[model samples]
Target: MSTPSPTMPPWPAESDHASGWSLVRAAAAAAEAAAAANRPARYALVAATGLLRELAPEEEGGLLAWEPGTGWRCLLPPQDCRQAVADLYLPLCAAHAARPITVAHLGQSLDGFIATGGGDSYYVTGPANILHLHRLRALCDAVVVGAETVLTDNPRLTARLATGPNPLRVVLDPSRRLPATHHVFSDGAASTVRACLAPNAAFTPGAADLVVAERGGRLDLADLVRQLRARGCSRIFIEGGGVTVSAFLQAGLLDRLQVAIASLLIGEGRPALMLPGREPLAHCVRPAARLFRMGEDILYDCDLAASTAAPAAAAPNGQSLQRLF
Candidate 1:
């Protein structure tokens, strides 16, 4: 619990307390504004701390503040702010302030399947995880998904469940196979980018931004990140169906990877990650992680960038895990 500040004034009578969701919305607004100005989003949050203070009046006591260097902390007591909310989100806020970040997230069963063999993946986690995904979209400048996800789900890729602006939608369809009629390409809810290896003449102008990547055996992931960054999408979210997220991870492009493990089991289906296997446990990628319980789901928020930058640590015995690629 946080203690009340002796010197700070109480919250205004007109705005006594703010709901956690309200704060989430406010943070999203700040991030959106920051992206528009091409500045680190955390600066906006810092500038608005005074305004946020009103949500947690000194008398009532429960305030949360996030800094790039120090991370999240309470300025006043009772620590009324929801810890789960802060734990789940503050890293994202910090990521915005630190540098351009590429994050990938997936929800899977305890057995590691994202869906059944027949492709039925309606609710792997619970409502809370779904809302968390929406919050992820709300906080990012762009949300990416592979062609299979588009063909399978036809998702709108909007932050409809959360109180924030919809993110720019990006579809990773290397072959340009997804039809223009999909909701992401046709709905016009937000600007959409169709990234492919070749331009499809069938797509009409303004249908969506057509980004033709350099022709390799596959789309160049690094070049793709550069192009997206050039377009001012500094915070990218890879919301996916495994293969695409795995590709980014293998290419060492992901800054963070979040996987929500549900209590149920799919027994056998598509795996959550498809990385090459390491014969020894010490050779596996061991990222720094923080865990959060969301209803029935357990989210393992892995810090890939931190793990990759730091020196490899010794495992349980004398052996050390392989350095992240």
Candidate 2:
């Protein structure tokens, strides 16, 4: 990837002696500037943490820092401001520290259904989770979904409720079945990309820019990611319709996965994820997860890479659920 622009905002100066609320403000300012410039906030936060240490040695642990040996490490205690700082910086930090962070998100009912039998899913989770998804879109460079989701939901896929700029909307439509009249296609709020298996003569171009990456009549997701990265979309958010999310999970391309589980149950409907079955329980994929209460819903934030390396532990909310293998 090309170097970020020199015109991008610089980190807080050490000489400023920022502390307490000022430190928080500085970190927030740096994050906002990075987002505005379309640059990774992690780099700026790294510099900001150094300044934080210089300003207030006692508060050094609170500022998000990156260690070469252990990756992103945060020593902050539980506090509202600290949590807020972490909420803003952690995603960017994780994205920048990794090769390319691909997070898949899903909002489903308690029984793991994403929609009703007829595909009528107005809101599975609460408003808080919806806002959280929008925030995730704001953090990511691109937001992706399957063409089936586009046809079923007709979502606008914009960062409307969030503060940051809208992400590039990506649709994986191997067969080019999605209509040009889809809201995502006609919406000019953000740039759109339509990745298909090949250039079809029958398909008419619309607001979306078309890209073809075919491999045995299938859209090569790895190639698609490379193309997106080439276009400066390093971090991707997969907002899915089951199959798309499952494909990425089975391919081991997803770094993080967030699922919002609502209180209600849809007894019969679309399943959230569909992976191949393993004969033995030990052979199943088990990711380390943390749970949080978002309004009436419970949010599961999982770290796929950490699951293999660390033992499963109870979440901060003192609830533990078996990994959805």
Candidate 3:
């Protein structure tokens, strides 16, 4: 979808005009009516006529719904809506509903570099994408990153730019090399999880809860996922420094992948994704991607699971081997 117009307001604004106030009152009334009827109501306010009218069944658009405690909420049609704002919320809601959905996101340059060779990745994308990341963190139950990201960026990983509770911070440090002085550890704004390969006896986490899931001196990604699931993290957002993201993708654990490409080109730097596979072109992943613009950056959302080839035929035993795609 095209980018939202620059002149459009971030949200509906209150104005001294009577028509604006009437629209607000109509919306409130519609929400209450929907709540009383135990169903959502759809209405559109015509600016020229200054009237709020119920949408017909054939009409194709989003609606404003009302919940008892929560006033009014926008309900957009996932497949029908062309609004750029819908691009952000629809995927997020879909992930939230799934059983432990995992999404990996990265902001890279035109040349596919996530950071400079020196590891200076600050402002790789525009300010809008940074806010978009915050929105993702707000929606997810947990946000994960690698030890190198923690050391290099020292990000707070909180939802400061968005409206919602901050998700739990997860640091994958197989060697426990990250220090306790990082902003994610010392910020105290959100709960943190430190997953390492070493046993509890070998190391102590600084300010975050410690989780040791080691198998052959490596942090088991599947085990880590189970731990997060046990903690009621239904949706996990993996924000990274290459290796961590690569590990998840290699494991075929990611449900969705969103890559935001910036306008500038960083000739040499850290790559965004690095899956090691020597499969032929036909066997390679070719997820159906959709594009959206977030300020100057172009966001590509890929559905990994759906885009993979279908499962092979079952064996003579009437059992099919489960595939991870």
Candidate 4:
């Protein structure tokens, strides 16, 4: 994959670093510059000094860091910036020093549809939500999607709108049906991985790698996650077309999920998060969520780890009761 551009916004002086947003931007820019220069991107918040410090691999001390589900913590007693950090980018930074972090996101209309009857979904959410997605791509190691997403949106899967290293693009085409002319495979903007049941010899996966995983005519989602983790992709982002995101969520593999609800309504189309029917409200997956406003869209950041078991309610024929948010 090509290295990102070195040009980035100038960081405010250390004394002027009062806002959490500014600190996050500075850290993200530094990490991108490190990647561009072929160096390790190591950064953290020093607990005692209350400063965002760049550290060497061997360095150890009172550093504040975040982990999935557990939130941010420090070696020593932390300063008063925890709330500020958490409010801005602590969730994204969870992958910084952690491993096997998998997150999923889906954008749908008020009517619970991702696309129209004919499958035409271009800008469901506004620019702010789009930027949030780009930021997710920027922070993660790999971005994943399913075959239908490749056939429909044909997304680039790059952090083009944000400042960071572009993540590896992963397309899960279990049947090997996607044409290699798709942007993720042919663009060469970022490294791509095609996960399928078998390799089609005739199809040139230009600048892309191939991985195979199947079980009883289905792609093994767990196996795919293991393979990605083995490849040093500790952080994975499931950026999708409805079905793909739904599959991950159903598998109970997602640590966090961000569902963006747009104001528009697509009455009959591809729905998001199609899970099994659950009759009882108690058996439903009720996760702890934080709401964030993104232009006209309202994003529900749900912590899947903190949620109750999602084995579906015991009641019969209660499919409509399983909706989240």
Candidate 5:
């Protein structure tokens, strides 16, 4: 329910209305052109709006306008543009229509990761990225990590910014990596799910609701996706170490890769993207990609931008799907 702008000139002729792919294309073309030029798409929609002028419905109305990132939105009764993008993404993402998931990587040094080192592995990315990441978290429906990560790092697994309900916290404990005595079980009464290897394992009050099940070989991956989707999780964020990163990449299930490289890379510290074994790059993972920089590190945002040749899936220590989400 939006307030209609009385000042809006009525939509044009019936001949002008874009009801099918034609109209969608027009809107998308307009949006894309405008965004590319760093200009507003307002004028484009205005031009398209005239198509229905012929209809001149007794109650003239219909149209929506707003920037995607910035929520400056408005409606004139009948038309709503805010919902257009998702629709657009659907067709645009037909082959890759998994959902607009993003993996936010917080690279750390040997000293510590995310302000958290061996002794003090508190936080990895700084305030800015942390803020941005929280915003991302709020935008998503779920957050994930692997089990070993839980053993080592007792993360609250909660979105602390961009307030709203926190994303559901998920753990991929393939082998029941998290003991019933783990902190995740003791933390606030937050919504959490632990995917374990033993499907019928008895649960303790602390970790009673764990999703314990043995994933069948290559099928474990499918089960993971199905479980999350069943939870109504459309957008996922994987934020963790290397193993998971390599897993998703190798599986070719990884949709997007967003890695933030800190200015100070502990040259001698841990390696990022743990795919295991020194395989020849020619036979390893490949993805089509791009880069952006925030603060000191560069953000490598890849959309299957790596090599077409898949890498041999290897689960190394600290390497878990937790990183990809």
Candidate 6:
């Protein structure tokens, strides 16, 4: 696949689209530059996700959508930002000073759909989107999903197509309540880790690398990050339901936001994210973002609080769930 050029505007009829091809070119350039670093996964997720955001419809031939409830999928879009971010680029962009972790905050349409939010979970997104996300998994050190998500979706969060090691399985469960018989627990796709608050609580058929975050009887996001890093986790991806996504955003653990906004909107069940109800949504370290054109939906790419002096001076929000990423 030839590299998508950055000199051209990706879409045709949307003057509302406010960005240039520089971002797209920068993403590929970043990936290529980092590949020389020879770190675990090349680019930082921030740069990789940038590629996804800048992906113009022109780059990908077209977009393909599959049936709901299907596992394996393929894409035939004109050019896919998702494919660039996860598949060929992100892995080559991984850095190691404070090694980077690529975590994603994603959710389906309101009615539990990814493609067209209604009654479709499996085939809600176009084939390109599915394949693109799969690439992100391929380059990650860990893929996190909330217990609630596991119980509801029962998805096998491992890379299937590309040949390589599967990322470590990390479940963000403050409560320890997964059954040993559960699909994720028994899948053997990757090393399973239950990041829970409960003290060594029992899992039906327990998995290894149990990370306990008991900060005053609650799960500590900071501690969780520390442990993950120690275990050689340079890039992490968090795919979630509303609550989990909200927590990551609130804790400021997310380095990037890769959102696929479908042309159609659903006004019901679960919203995109359950952001904290704090009256003031304005924080000094607000995030910066860029938008990319996908088939019918738009991909919002954001860079969280990743400035040079950010993490050091920042203090955890008093009510942990009331902060921003």
Candidate with top TM-score is 1
Of the candidates numbered 1 and 2, which has the greater TM-score value?
Answer: 1
**Deviation from native of the Cα of residue 43 in model 6, angstroms:** 14
Please provide, for model 3 over 1-325, each residue's C-alpha lDDT reduced to its tens digit, 9 standing for 90 to 100. 4343332213221232223334443443343244455544566767676445667768866354444433355563433232345334444443322234798999999998899988999889988788779877877889999998988888999999765679899999776677788887777899887887654553334455556666667788888988888787877999997888888988888988999998888887988888777567668777766556566777888888668553324443353542211
RMSD of each: 8.3, 10.1, 10.8, 10.4, 14.4, 13.2
lDDT, candidate 3, residue 10?
A: 32
lDDT by residue (tens digit), candidate 5, 1-325 = 2332322212223233223223333433343333344432332233444221111234333443334443123233334332322232222211211333435354565333333335234445555456446644554567777665677777776666534347777777765546666666677546677766555446645553445334444226546766777666656777665556556655666667666656553433434565556567666555554433333344555556344676436533333442111
The number of the candidate with the highest lDDT is 1
What are the lDDT scores of the predictions, listed in order?
A: 0.70, 0.67, 0.69, 0.69, 0.49, 0.53
Q: Which stretches of candidate 2 lie over 4 Å from their true place?
A: 1-62, 69-72, 81-89, 201-210, 309-325
Winner by lDDT between candidate 6 and candidate 1: 1
Per-residue lDDT, model 5, residue 56, is 28
List the pairs of residues colliding in candidate 3: none
- Residue-pair clashes per prediction, in order, are 2, 0, 0, 0, 44, 26
> Residues 73-184, candidate 1, lDDT per residue (tens digit)?
4343434443346445655654443367788999999899898887788989888789889888988888999898889888999999876779888898887777788898
lDDT at 137 for candidate 2? Answer: 83
Encode model 4's per-residue lDDT on 114-230: one tens digit a residue. 888777888888887787788789778899998888888888999998766799898888766788899988988998888877776666656444565776687889888888887
Rank the models by TM-score, top first: 1, 2, 4, 3, 6, 5
Better of 1 and 4 by TM-score: 1
Candidate 4 accuracy as TM-score = 0.73
